[model samples]
Target chain A: MATTTMAAALGSGLRRAMEDDPRVVLLGEDIGRLGGVFRVTDGLQRDFGADRVMDTPLAEAGIMGVAVGLAYRGFRPVVEIQFDGFVYPALDQMVTQVGRLHYRTGGTVRMPVTIRIPYGGGIGAVEHHSESPEAYFAHTPGLRVVSCATPQDAHTMIRQAIACDDPVVFFEPKRRYWVKGSVEDEVLDDALPLDRARVVVEGTDVTLVAYGPLVVTARDAALAAADDGLSIEVIDLRSLSPLDLDTVETSVRKTGRLVVTHEAQRSGGLGAEIAASITERCFSLLHAAPVRVTGFDVPYPPAKLEEHFLPDLDRLLDAVDQVMGRQHSLTGWSA
Target chain B: MLRSDVSDGRALPTTEEPPDPELVQLLAPDGTRRADPVYDAWVEDVDAERLLSLYEDMVVARRFDVEAVALQRQGQLGLWPPLLGQEAAQIGSARALRPDDFVFTSYRENGVAYCRGAAPVDLVRVWRGNALAGWDPWAIGMATPQVMIGAQTLHATGYALGCAKDGVDSVAVAYFGDGATSKGDVHEAMVFASSFAAPVVFFCQNNQWAISEPVGLQSRHPLADRALGYGIPSVRVDGNDVLAVMAATRVALDRARRGEGPSFIEAVTYRMGPHTTSDDPTRYADPEVREQWAAQDPIVRVEQHLHTRGALSEDRAQEVKEHAEAFAMELRDATYGMTAPEPLTVFDHVLVQPSAELERQRSQYAAYLAMFEGTSGGDE
Candidate 1:
C-alpha cells in the first residue's frame, strides 16, 4: 500500500485500468503533454503512448461525443472535463446521447464512457473554475454520478466507474485533490460497490449525510458535536444517482435525526432528494425534520464572497444543532 | 444560383474557394454520360450491372420513403423524415462502404439505414414508438440516427480515432445536411479529425434546406469550401447523380483507409418532400426552384441514362417496378402488424446493471398497472 493524494491515486487507478485492458483509452484537453490541469492523469500518456492518451482540441462536446463513439466501438474511453463549469458545453451530448443510447437501444448497446470532472470550490478560483455542477449530472438518468471524498475511494471508484457497463459521471473535488491517504494496490474482491454509501464516522444522536467536498466539512462538524456530547454519524454518499438510500436510511433510523450537507444550491440539490427520501422512509423514526446546510441559490459567487457562499463547519453544526432541538447557532443574526 | 461556370461542361464552381472546380459528374440529367478527369478514374469499377443495381436501390428507397409518409399520415408512425431527392446521395455513398465500415448519421438517413441492411420492420420500430432505436448498432455497424444536429460527426470522428488506435483499417462515415455545417459539433469534429488524422469521411448531403432555413443562410460559400479551412481535402459532387456520389465516396474511403487522414464530400442534393411529416416545405421553398430541382430527379435521370444506353428495356423497367412494389408492401405490412410493446419495457435498459431507484419505480408502476387490471375503469 502506498500513501498518495487523491490526484495521484486517480492517476494510478487510470494507469492500472489501462494496463489491464488494451481497449481502455483516455481522451481530454491537455491530458497528454500536460497530464491534466490538476495533473490527475499525470504520466499516463508517457506510459500508454499518444494514441491511447489523446490530447484533444479544446472542445468538450467533441471530447464527449467522441468518447461515446469510442464506447460504441467497444473501447472504454475515460474523458476528463477540465473544470465543473466547463462541463456544460458537453451536457447535450451527456444527457441526450450518452445517457439515452443504452436505454434507447434496449440493452443491445452499452455506453462505458467515464467522464471525470474536477469540481467544487475553496481553491479561491475565478468564475467557471470553482463551481459545483454535480446536481445537473445527478438529475440526468442513465448516468451513474459519483464523487470521492478520500484518496482510497477516488482510487477504487475511478476503476469501478470505468469497469461499469453504463456511462458514469465521476466528479473529483478539486480542493480535496491534494488530500492524501493510503490506497491498497490490489482492490479487495469484497470492496464496496461503486454506488453504495459508507459511514465514515459512526455515532447515534444525529446523522450527517454528505458527499464529495462536504464530507470533510461534515466530519469536522461531527468532531465538534462530539465535544458537546451530541453523537453525530457521518455518512459519505459515494453514489449520487442510485443514492445508496439504504445505508442513509439505516443510519438515520438509528440516529432518529438527519442533517444533509452539500456544496450545491439548496433547492433541488442531492440534499433535497436525500431529505425527501429519508422523510418518506424514516418518518416514524425521526425526532425532528431533516435539515440541510448547502450553498446559496445564487450563482457561484466571485472568489472574494465564495468563502461565505460555501457550506462551512459552522453552517453544518448550525443545521445539526437545529435538528437536535438546540438554540440557533446565531441567535438573532439573520433577523 | 450557379456559382461557377459550366462552360467546359466539366467544371461547376458552387463555392468561391475552389479546391477543384469540377462537380464530378458521371451522368447528366439529359440522359448523357459526362466524364470527369478526376472522378472518372474512380468510377471505372462501376460496370453496367452495378449501375442497374444502384438504380434498383434508389427505386426501392424512394418507395420506402413514400410508404413511410403514408404510414405517418395514417397515424401508424409518430413521424417520418423523407429522404426523397437525396436517395442517390445516401444510397450511392452507402453502397461504396464495406459492411464493416461504421456509419453515424442524422435522423434523415433512413436510406443509408436501409443500405446498411436494417430490416424494414426494424426501420420503423423507433418511429412506431415500439423501441428507442430500431436495430442494434453492433449488428448493423451503423449507430442509431442522432437527432441532435451535426453531433454524429463528432462521434464518427471519435470512432475513427479509436479505429486508428486499434490499428483497424475500418473507416467511420458521418452523414449530415448543409445546415449541420454551421453547428459547433461539426466544426469540432473537423478540427479533431484533421489534427489526429483520423480515418473519417464527412459526407454532407446538402439537401438545401434545414426545415425552413435555406442553405444560403448557413453558408456564404458552398459547404464543401468550408472543409478546406480545416486543411482536409474535399469534393463537390452532383448529389442527384448516383455514379458521381459513388465515385466520390469510393475516393474518400480509399484515402481514409490508406491512412491519408479525413476527407469531406459535399453532395449537392435537394429535399423534394417536407423536412419531416410535421413540416410544410411550401412555406419556405419557392415553386420555381423546386420545379428546377425536380427536373434533375435522381432515379428518373438514372432510368433515362440506362434507356439511352438501351439497357433499361420495358422488361427491365417492369422488373424494377415489381421489386419496389413488393418491398414497399412488405414494409407496410410489417409496420401495421407491429404490436405495441409492454408499458414496463420502458424501464428495461436505463442502465446496464439494475438501478435500485429505477427498480423501486418499476415495481410501483407494476403495482399501479396491476391495479387497473380488474378495475373496469371504475364504472362499477
Candidate 2:
C-alpha cells in the first residue's frame, strides 16, 4: 500500500492489469510516449511495450471502433478518449457498436472493452474541455458507466472495470488527477462491487448523494453541515448506469431527506435518476421532497466562470438546507 | 448536379475520373477464360470441381435471396436487402478466406454468410424481425451484418491488431460497399490498420451505389486509389468474375498473414436490385444503365464459363437447380415457423452479470405481464 495521486494510482492499476493479463492492452492518442494528456498512463509504454500500450492516431471514432474489434478478438482493450469533449466523435461507435454488439449477437459474444474518458469540468479550461457527458452513456443500455473519486477507488475500480465482462464507460475525474490518497496495492477479495455506491461519511439528518468529482464537494458540505448541528451522510455513487439505487434508497430511508449533487445539468442528469428511484423506493420514509444541486441547463461556460458553474460546497449545503426546510443562512465562509 | 433531359451518349460513369485499365480479370464476360499471369497463379488450385462448387454456392445464395425478397413482398419479412448482382464479390472473397480468418461485413453479405457455412434458418431470423442478430458471429467466424455504414471496417482493423499483438497469423477482413469508403470511420480504420501493420483486408464491393447515390458521387478516383494515401497496397478487380475475386482475395489475405499490414480490394460491380424492399429503384435508377449492368451478370458469366469448359452437363445443371430449390424451400419453412421471442428475454444479454436494476425491472415487467394472463375480453 502507498499514498499516491489518482493519476499515479490509475497508471499503477493499468500496469497491474496489463501485467496480470496478457490480453489487456491500452490504446489511445499520446498515451504512449506522452503517457496521456493527464499522465494517467505514465511509463506504461516503457514497462509494457508499445504493443500493449498503443499510441493510436488522433481519431476518436477509430479508437472506439477498433477497441470493439479488439474486444471481439478476445483482447480486453482499454481505450482512452483523452478528454470529456473529445469523446463525442467516438459516441457513435460506443453507442451503436460497442453497446449493442453483445445483445445483437444474443450473448454469443461479450465486448470486454473499457473506454476511459477524463470527464467533468472546473480546471478553468476552454469550451468542450470542461463538461459532464455521463448521462449520454448511462442512457445507453449495453454500457456500464462508472466514475472514481479517491485514489483508492481509482486504483481498484479502473482494474475492476477492466475485469468486467461488459463494455464499461469509465469516466475519470480530470480535475482530481492530483488528489492524493492511500491506494491498496492489492484488491481485497471482499471489496465492493463496481456498481454499488460507497458511503464515504456516516450521519443521519440528510443524505448527500454524489460521485466522481462532486464527492469531495459533498463531503465538504457534510463536514460544514456538522457545524450547523445538522448531521449529513455522504454517498459516493461510483456507478451511474446500473445505479446502486438500493444503497441510495437505504440512506434516504434512514435520513428521511436527500440532496443529490453532480457536475452535469440537473434537468436530465444522474441526480434526476437517483431522486426518482429513491422516491419510488423510499417514498414513505421521506420527510421532505428530494432536492438536487447541479450545473445549470446551459453549455459549459469558459474557465473563468467554472467556479460558478460547477456545484461546490455552498451549492450542496444550500440544497441540503432547502431539503431540511431551513431558512437561508448567511453565516457560510467567504470564497 | 445539373439535370439533363434525354441524356443519351453520355459515359456510364459520367465523370472524368481515370479508368482502371488494369482491372484484374481471370474470365471474360463472354464465358471465355482469360489468364492474368500474376493472379492466375493464386487460383491455380481452383480446378473444374471447385469451379462447379463455386457455381452451386452462388446459385444457392441467389435462390435464397429471391425467396427472401418474395417473402418481403408477401409481408412475411419486415424488409430484405438483396445481394442480387454482387454474388461473386461476396462468395469469391469469403471462400478465399481461411476458416479462422474473421469477417466483418455490411448488411448485404448473405452470400458471404452462406460461404462461411451459416444455416438457412440462422440467416433469416433477424430479417424475420424475430431476433436482434441473424447468426452466431463466433460460430461462423463472421460478425452480424452491420447496418451502420463503414463501422465494421474499424472493428475488422482492431481485431486484426489483436491478432497481430497475440502473434496470430489470422487476418480480419471487412466487407463494405463503395459508399462506405466515403465515411470517416472507414478512412480512420485504414489509417490505423496501416500505422499498426495490422493483419486486415478492407474488401469493398463497389456495387456502384450507396442507396440511390452513384459511386461517382462518393469518389473522384477509383475506390482502390484511396488506400494508397494511407500507405496500404490495394487492388481493383472485375467483381463479376469469381476467379479474379478469389485470386485477389488470396493475394490480400496472404499479404496480411505475411505481416505486410493491410491491403484494400475494390471489386467493381453493380447492385442489380433496389437498395432494399422498401426502396423504389424506378424513382432514381435509369433503366438503360440497369440494362447495361445486367449484361455483365456475375452468375451467368460463371455458368457460361463452366458450360464452355464442358464441366456443366445437363445432369449437373439439374442437380444444382434442385439443390438450390431445396435450400430455398427449407429457408422459407424455417422463417414461416419462427415464433415471436419471449418479451421478457429482452432482459438478458445486456451484461455478462445481470444488474440489480435489470433484475428489479424484469420482475416488475413479469408482474405487469402476468396481470393479463387470465384476463378476458371486455364486454361492450
Q: List the residue pairs that clash in candidate 1.
A: none
Candidate 1 versus the native: TM-score?
A: 0.96
Interface RMSD of each: 0.8, 0.8
Candidate-wise lDDT, in order: 0.89, 0.89
Candidate 2 regions exceeding 4 Å error are: A329-335, B1-22, B377-380
Off by over 4 Å in 1: A332-335, B1-22, B378-380
Q: Write the per-residue lDDT of candidate 2 for residues B239-310, one digit (tens) a residue.
A: 888999999999999999999999999998888998999988788787787887788788898899989889
Best by DockQ: 2
The 10-residue segment with the lowest total lDDT in model 1 chain B = B12-21
List, residue by residue over A15-52, the lDDT tens digit for candidate 1: 98898788999999899889998998889999889989
